[model samples]
Target: MELIAKATALVGGTIAFVRRMNSPQQQAFGTAPEIPEARKQGIMTLKMPAAEGWKDGHLPTCAPGLKVNAFASGLDHPRWIKVLPNGDVLVAESKEQAGPPKTLMDHAAQATMRRVKAIGKSANRVTLWRDTDGDGTAEIREVFVENQNQPFGMELVGNRFYLGNTDGIRVFDFTVGDTALQGSGEKLVDFKPHGHWTRSLLASPDGSKIYAGVGSLSNIGDQGMEVEEGRATIWELDVASSDARIFASGLRNAVGMAWEPVTGKLWTVVNERDGLGDETPPDYLTSVVDGGFYGWPYCYWGQTVDDRVPQDAELVAKAIQPDYALGGHTASLGLCWMPEGTLPGFGDGMVIGQHGSWNRSKLSGYKLIFVPFKDGKPSGPSRDILSGFLSEDEKLAYGRPVGVVIGPDGKSLLMADDVGDIIWRVTGA
Candidate 1:
């Protein structure tokens, strides 16, 4: 017995040593290319000398004769955006960070769990702007609301505007000309904070149901929440009833969601579990089916079982894997479908916002990519529709795009860059 125990210990030590020694590239399970900082910096900072033809005129890469435009510069971490019916854009600026005292405890007997006071920060504000003239510039900049918590994701449905904050979800009736949010908003739901705090909100086409993506509280399931509850799941709530339930389970973090125009299916770009040495699990873009499991804590990306967690053979068999996987750690967000009839170049394509990476030593993603589809599904490789949002010197990024919306003209595209506080316009020449 003693000899057997010694042998087991020796084997475990060897495995641990091997894992630690493996390079980040070797640990990555998929075909994601490792983007070195030097290369990323070079690509991001590459400055193009203004050519006479390309100097100030908009060139349409997606469609002929279409022009894109930008609006409102000098924003501070602008996030989640929506286009109002009046041709104005509504943006949520998330500026607050919940600190340590609010940490949750497993049991009531644990004396360490303490309540913390809610403190307000000046950075939290919501802004609205309108491009009244068709010149692609925001002529009016107005503050819609102020003194709120960290607001991230937003959905504009009918006459109401819904916002996803760190604490929970809130909604207000939106009036076009109102300078300040007049009436008190109603709270739809509340959640215990844990894991990644960025919550993304989406609504059904008819606005009957609302969905919110909540990230896992831990790197894996080490924090001990139910595998089927709270973290890593899409919460579905009836907009009018205010009742909520789990729509889907087992996604580590889904930051972006959109409804496909042709298929009418819900698709999401998910940020997979981290700490598997940078790239074990690849980020994914897939059609999310109700009650489907995407494998968190135990497996990843369709049957690639993880070694960190305890094995569950039955659960592994039941997990529904992603349809398409993007490169790992790309930090994908904000998916929007190209509308019909504006640009031939944008026909049947999906625009995804790669928010860029932070966990790895090297950085990847910082632009908008378009994935063309055949028969209403992703067909081939995605192409860079808009690049150089981050400066040529990758070390300092000028803009980090979070949300994308098709302009009122239908020929142009509008992107919201949170870090740079600027909205960029992409139009075809």
Candidate 2:
């Protein structure tokens, strides 16, 4: 047994060394990242941290003049958050479903996700928490709705509440002060489900239209473009007529969407494709344009063609460049606008929750970041609002932040830690 253990350790060390040697040296982040030439690999790099739940006073590290605490804990895979006008917080807790592995890369990726406790049976529910006294912690916790198919996004438009489930949009009757969802929802629009299944929903300012972000069915259309029709695009749905159309296209996996108050334009954070060397193309944050394409299988970063993909010169020529880069493989997920006074010493900007990286020899993200905006555009370097999600050795992660939103009071920040199963509140020290 001792000899076998030694052999396993030696093999692991060699594999880690190989990964380090193959990883690109430079990091691609910020508005003008240096996207290097593609270095396609026969086998993709995979580095998933082991899961370790927080215990005995363990918490994330906050930036100077800020503090972090658990607002609610002991939940199950809470991935998204929505704050109601009446001060109630709703959390969407869902689990990932892994499909059968079709290739060597797929097998390795699925195995890593499973080992890190990421994929499992869907929770299929959203829970509501109330803090009536203005304290950071919740005093009331209960199920707001249940029996949904992997719900991710939630929006309340007047008396109607909309949910973005894996397969469709569901509308429920809701009141501002209500504690529980009253009935089963009505299906508003059907969405294709499977690969990259999250459907993030956003409502227009006038509440007359809804936009949904749908990811590609496979990375770079490896499963054929026929299976990718209507995927990798944002869909705009007319509320009154229930008519839906593609608002934008060619975004690989646009997850988080928000309206920039100053510009009155829609913005989104996209997760780019993997397998091209560590820094070949960076995930990005950009203002979404109506009838625009942002490049998927054919190209990236404004017509830098991906040679591996089957060529579409016309489509590549039409691909619009993203506004800013958010670091390669960072998995930057949650985004919300922060007003100037929301956090002391911080000006108006956007707060991003990065769930960390998996396909790099070294990790990136795993914290909440603030990108300062001036005159409606990113003005300076990103700052860390919260960190220390990973352990000192980087072998284990205590938590991973996903959804982010300003509390109803308009001063504090609420973040969802999916691995730790806790909602963390951030406030001025």
Candidate 3:
């Protein structure tokens, strides 16, 4: 079985060379894709460009009047980043560990992982970078926190710093200007292990609680709904009691989230279900309502029922329509709102890092996109601001971004490029 899977991967690997895709029109970015009559979504497309590290002095394409630089490099697989109050940048160097294959599909998935070489070993640590002077780059690097269990998200509220490991949320006390955490941490909440392991976290405005986005274990409940009990939704947890409850449901994968600064509404970028052809369903960025269901396995983008999953009339009825559709299989993950008076002409909008497509015939979303927000709602089309992750030949990618955050000073943007092990800083020139 292993040998056959490996052979299949070789044939599939060659197809990665062909990634140029015929995507929908520009209107597809801000509105939902046209849902076709019910149909069984196709099998996996198995398309992906190999990660090729940047050549000497190579950088991603920046928008006009802006510039890009490697804020910090020479690290392991850094998946997420957070800017601390003290101007230190904390990066989560993590990757999913290869577990034993229990099903034939699992074996095939491992083979595909070996072929793409996209995900690397988790360093199980959060490294810190501090620019001692007023330089635009870091002057010192330290392991701010370590021995974590595939950690991804982080938030510091008052004296307690919270870190979201794949299996749990840990809290540690901290003081200003501390170089490293000294304790093992108090576990706040336990989570189901290692499917979509990135547990994205955000503290409430009042610092009384935090929200965590947990992704589904398998696409469209392929592993059965029984195992998906605590998955596919955001959870709100009380800071003092450590009590958690489901905040929203049917978000297949809420990868990045933030509070809309204007209205204090929570927003997230979701990785929608795949195999839905090239255009049937689109991933989205939307305001997450408390106790809202956005339709994951049984439906997508509001009332479009997924023909593949077991349907429930109640779930279909309760599904809330998303505000904006990004694009089909765009794999949009990272999101950060831009501050006012920082980048003129950008105005008030959110910046999202699109990790690009892996299942589409033609590639989409390999850069930073800006969606203008008016009065706390997405009011314009998402346009590319940074790009060129793909090589000219289209056979290789220099980077795939994950975490995106505005710097603490609000003057620059930081993006975590997991494939290249680099955190890119974007600033006005």
Best candidate according to TM-score: 2
Error of 1 at 210 (Å): 1.4
TM-score of each model, in listed order: 0.78, 0.96, 0.94
lDDT for residue 93 in candidate 2, whole number 0-100: 92
The positional error of residue 30 in candidate 1, measured at the CA in angstroms, is 11
Clashes of 1: 19
Tens digits of lDDT, candidate 2, 1-429 = 234334433443455458778766777877888887887855666777778979999889999999988899988899899998888999999978877777755666666665456787878899999987878899899899998999999998999999999998999999988778887879989998989888888899999999999999988999899999999999999999989999999999998888889999999999999888677688888999999999998999999998889999999999999988888888888989899999888999989999988776677779899999988898888899999998877678899989999987898999999899999999999
Q: Tens digits of per-residue lDDT for model 3 on 1-429?
A: 458555645655444333223334442467444654433433465656767878888889988878888889987888789888889899999888877788765665666554445444679999999988867788899998888899999999998999999997999998758889888989989999767888999999999989999999988898799999999999999997889999999999998998898899999999888775655577899999999999988998888888788899999999999988887777888988886666545778888998887666566777888888999999877767789998765568888887899976688889998878899988888
**Candidate 1 segments whose C-alpha is farther than 4 A from its true place:** 1-69, 95-98, 101-122, 177-179, 226-228, 340-344, 390-393
Residues 154-226 of candidate 1 have per-residue lDDT tens digits of 7777777888876688889877656557566988888556456677889999999998988887667774657
Q: What local distance difference test score does each model get?
A: 0.65, 0.86, 0.82
**Which 10-residue window of candidate 3 scores lowest in summed lDDT?**
16-25
TM-score-better candidate, 1 vs 3: 3
Question: Mind sharing the TM-score for model 2?
Answer: 0.96
Question: Which 10 consecutive residues of model 2 have the lowest summed lDDT?
Answer: 1-10
Please tell me which model should have the higher lDDT, number 1 or number 3. Answer: 3
Ranking by TM-score: 2, 3, 1
